[model samples]
Target chain A: MISRRNWIRYSGAGVAASFIPTSHASQGRVVVIGGGFAGASVARELRRLNNALSVSLIEANAIYTACPLSNMVVGGHRKISQQQFSYAALSADGVNVIHQPAVDVDPERHLVTLRDGNTLNYEKLILAPGIDLDWQALQGYDKTAAELLPHAWKAGPQTTLLRDQLRSMREGGLVVMSVPKSPYRCPPGPYERASLIAGYLKQNNPRAKVLILDSKDSFSKKPLFLSAWQSLYGDIIEWQGESDGATVTAVNAENRTVSTDFETVQADVANIIPPQKAGKIAHLAGVTDRSGWCPIEPVTFSSTLQPDVHVIGDAAIANAMPKSAFAANAQAKLCAVQVTRLLNGESPVHGKLINTCYSLVAPDYGISVAGVYQPGEKIWTEIDGAGGVSPADASRETRAVEAAYAQRWFDNLTTQVFA
Target chain B: MIRTINRRNWLAGAGTLATLTVQPRLLAAVSEPVQSVLKRDFPTAEIQPGRVNIELPALAENGNSVRMKISVDSPMTPTDYVSFIQIIAQANPLPDVARFDLSHANGLAEVETRIRVSAEQDIVVVAGLSDGSLWSGSAHIVVTVAACLDALY
Candidate 1:
């Protein structure tokens, strides 16, 4: 997905609306459900492979808002507008970007049913519908709490709401962040949220502490985060890991406080990241595992439970990989190559995969981890010592260069996926 | 004007239909046969057992990327070595799963890796013993959230 900053400010809303309601649509068909990273990537990729391939991307929202860098938007670094991007890029690339929600997928008929009552048929269907919030997993913390404490996982307005909440808070007002345990959409997301909040906290409200209540005892990039937190915020930020029994099991909307299994914490603002699952369509299509994700072959990415269906990105089970946009991009590219092979009647060749997830520790401070894996014993096995966290003592100049590279990385990825 | 199936699509499609036509091939492979590649490589008779086993997480929170380990219950003796092992997810999109080739030179008939289990399903590990015996083991897991769904969500 594109970052919220570029998407919001950089994109012109009415940009693609002209060519969107097309004068004509061609015959061949390639249906892409989600317009996010993987969906957009696959859609653009298939077209690039064969311009004649009928490509249509169905996004739930007309304006494609991004989730990447949404933490910055929430931290008040910049407005959400700066993070936004228009679907016009997809259009320019000859992708039929449909602004509609996809409701059903009938593999038997090779058809996708849209909420608008339109049925799209395709020879090759790519479903990159991203993720959906599993509100049922947490009681009393439904969409209502999301309004009070937005997940901002999907970006857009929720991100703006989070920023507004942060901006309007009185000095010394508490900020509580709720982080899911594991296997969520973004592994380092909550930690990044905390870091960015601490960034905001350090600048704006020194007396106002930012409390991070996590569902896990530890988190991604722990060493770097703790060190930075200590160096930057010192006593300003208080982190309560899961071991402290601070997992929020319930939320009291009236009281504006969250109740964990152990203790109750009240804050001026809260960010509750609910459990996540595949898009509702995957479950409806009966391709999702009991864990609410799709299982696929390690080599080809074809669905394990279903014939003729393939799952990619965050929706598929790619081992030893974190749920980050970069990993999703890697999975999508790998799947794209696999799809090309499968379409050509050749089986996908097994090969080593490389994944590098770069997270911004601070504006000028960046850290990353890289991994390489190959199919072994019917699954992906990480090559020993092939990947690890960025060194703890990395210099400020290096971090600054890495941060700049991070921006360029997002640019390059979006261009690769959509442009 | 051009309505021809690409040779590979035709092969994949025809191979799929041919399996339905050849009931005996499916049944034969089920009990005593092997994957076409394996069968082609080792056209010998039955497998004589040494031993093979798979180790994996008893439970995983995110089934998308679950770790798995497979080991042959064997002492890589020249006289008796586990030649190959296949790990298959009985319920994944592709049932063929992953295939591994081993020899005495490797010293160990063991492998460890991470697997994405779509749902709570049985992971089946089949081993080809040095003597040409095929032994199998399966594990049933309860996956709270499968891997693929996380991506598409």
Candidate 2:
């Protein structure tokens, strides 16, 4: 973990270096699209590893709202500002951070075109565009419908909208959440959201209910979540898996209802997490596969279909590795190391990769899953006898400790990647 | 060198190989719980550090079902083959995870199955050969608390 003192020290250097022009005579240029955990980490690490290399990070938003702890904001336990981060620290670290949307990519010419009709050239390109919700996958759920039924998946204004809706809802009203199938970002996120929302309603609106409609029969950390619901929230939170005909086929945004083959249920407020695909920039770069995600070579994370282009984070199809911030940070570091080696005319070897995902069942209750992975012949293989979840019968003290650790992890990770 | 030996040559050379025994190098390195389990299971045999390989995730997402694969470097011929394999999770409420019996008719000395790991602990796999010598391999797994939430924003 990086200390705040170290971050301040780097910021001091950035202040002094900002006056002088960056040297461009050493290494080739690297252009990274997207400024989330993956892209931001790679850009900063590249500058740290080889200061001579010119690195430019393109992101559409000026302030990034994190998805990790946004559930707290939705549950009215935390403020949205707490989840917001700026790129100023990264800019101070000698990274050329650009606040603009990337509209097109010409891989043949190694050029990325911004929305303002400006283009950036690069020797190597890294894409960490994350996931874009599939609007067409669910009928009657488009950008306009999102205004009525907030997904809150991106953790910004949508998060506030959902929170406000819950606050104004009637005491006996039902808040419905629809979850997509497997391979979506944050496999266990909807449940965590449900848990936190239920906790909020249990205190403020005692009679309100939170219903989860899942497209899949099972979810990550199922037993722990179920036990938490049973012990903490009781019947305030109810779940219907795919086998129970809870798969949402369409959304009637006007009536605030979702329809499955079995029935159509109206809700006071609907949160729809639609199906997803690689972000637009990834698709423009021609790196995504039929699965609508980028397939990368296990060792270096380069695109299997395109040369000199690498994809990381949720945009990449990482076997056995869930789409989480921890996994993205791990992948970004490895990608940075490999990209450096390749630029120096050396072969890239596999490195130690691990992921730790922590979820908050309540304000003081937390759980996590961790795994160590190795690059196999074609994909990543989870190392045997190494990783598992928390014990079923853990004490309250254990849960509290994990909750503290989760906060520390968020602080350390955000500082490492963005600050 | 073993990879180049033919099946017929391996059978013919079994008589000389049967007398060779590997040093018990892992005996001093294992934890106390693992040592106790090993001592109870193979009191008379020297548990050596070769021939057996245990493949499991270094970290697991769930402790309820963890996939484990164990393979032994044996000819599996009538003359020299693996007889049985025993698995033990030193920290589990029940130390014994599972046990598998094998024979020459099985063709290969490999077993794949899933086991529940209660916590972070060292899992040991012991293979008993037809010659009465025991070979072992072990892996340490960390069972973390699982939340599985993605921070992609």
Candidate 3:
């Protein structure tokens, strides 16, 4: 499962000072690929625990915009800048934040090749490449179609494009959104987007309608959303599951039409969330299984297919955990601790892992689901009675408070990952 | 320390095991318990968790405004439909967060809203169907700040 990279000599100035710590003088180097929540947290946590251990974080992007709250940006409730974060703070903490995409990993030689032809040697490597959409799976929906339809799943240009399209759309027009099946990132995300879009349409174009055609028979938080749709905006939102002919078979982006087996839907704006797979780097490193996600050792998050390498975040097949930002951060913290232990010649022990995800139905309304998990015979198992969705039938004031908490949670999470 | 090779093959079949199935099933196969309210309300019904999905954060930064959504798998036909849906917080002072009365006219068995949580607790949802059966789903959340007990007044 190792892919060797061509060696390139690095300047001594950056390499010399990184090797000087006394306590971890023997741990060698730890290189983390991808600077998203999982990779960044592992790199920073490793340095925090043992300064002597050489750690390097390689990232393709200079700034990170979170996918958690990107829906709000598309809904115009938030600006993209508000969700954007910098790695300068992590750099200030003595992490060598290399802004380069890792091209290859050499497990036998313990070296990583960067796009700039530079190579980094490591005792261990952590990979967190997030997700890549399976564009081919969605007929007529590719990277080019994404530019027009705009899934807005990732937080950059696609988000802004969706917002712009919604703004310019005529009143009483249609908005068609197609959701992929399970195992995609943010299971409840598509529903939240529909709710927010419905809210926006209600305010600007009272006659407009939102149509959500889902591949699955149901989605997370079904009752709460149904109730909100009934009470918040009646007749403005229509959702169809597989039973109701909502499983999208193909999408005609040129005509802004999405076709299910039985019905063809036309929209002024269509958002087709395609099927997903592990990012390219995961496949390049040969850590992914048939599921298009990496399998890892539960205790250390090290790759099951590859040794001396760990897979975290959305790319890993964490069956017990969803591919959420919070889960990634939690896994990163655990991976950091376990990787450090491995370097120090200690065995990693089991621990409870936590994940909490919030979805905004509107600016003043929010909902969440949470769980506590521990290692099971197969994978991490949810602790009974430890987590569930937010209570239904909450008062307006409660919704407002939850909405406020959603904002705070976003802030808290970004700080933990980047700052 | 679980071994890697064997576990990987086993887990590959798991495919994110936390996912709740949507199709209705026999009650005895369900591992999670039916809320007492549902058990008492539909005495003859077999309550299960599948076909009912609750969307909410696993963690709450504050307890005040936890956004949530609930959806059930149903054809929404007259012969088989969801009659009502109820939301309950296991640890709240008044556990009945809200109850929604639905019918075949609703076209979909789903709802989205926000709720105030007093503390870290599990949220329970139960749906009564036309066939005199009950379906339920629950999710646990950790709330760092209390929303119900805040001294805003």
Q: How close is every model to the real structure, measured as TM-score?
A: 0.70, 0.70, 0.71
Model 2 DockQ reads 0.03
Isolated chain A: TM-score per model? 0.90, 0.94, 0.93
Superposition error at A392 for model 2 (Å): 0.6
DockQ of each: 0.06, 0.03, 0.02
Distance (Å) between predicted and true CA of B14, model 2?
51
Estimate the overall C-alpha local distance difference test score of candidate 3.
0.75
Given candidate 3, what's the lDDT at residue A384? 68
lDDT of 3 by residue, B1-153 (tens): 111112111112321222222334433222333234444455565555556788775444335566678988889899999988888775665666898999999999998766876654557677878887777666665443311223311
Error of 1 at A417 (Å): 2.6
Interface RMSD, candidates in the order listed: 15.3, 14.5, 14.3
lDDT (Cα, tens digit) per residue for candidate 3, span A1-419: 12111122233223432322233333447889988889888888987877766677888888888888888887778898987888888776667777778888777766787776667767798999999998877789998888889998887988889999999999799999999865678878898899888888899988989999987555677778888888888998999875676778798878888998788878899988998888988898889875577878777888988889999998987765778888999999999999988988998978889988888888898888788877765456567667777889788888888888988998898887776
Second chain alone, TM-score for each candidate: 0.63, 0.74, 0.69
Q: Highest lDDT among the candidates is held by which one?
A: 2
Off by over 4 Å in 2: A1-26, B1-153
Candidate 1 structure, TM-score to reference? 0.70
**TM-score, model 3 to reference:** 0.71
Candidate 3 residue B41 Cα shift, in angstroms, is 46
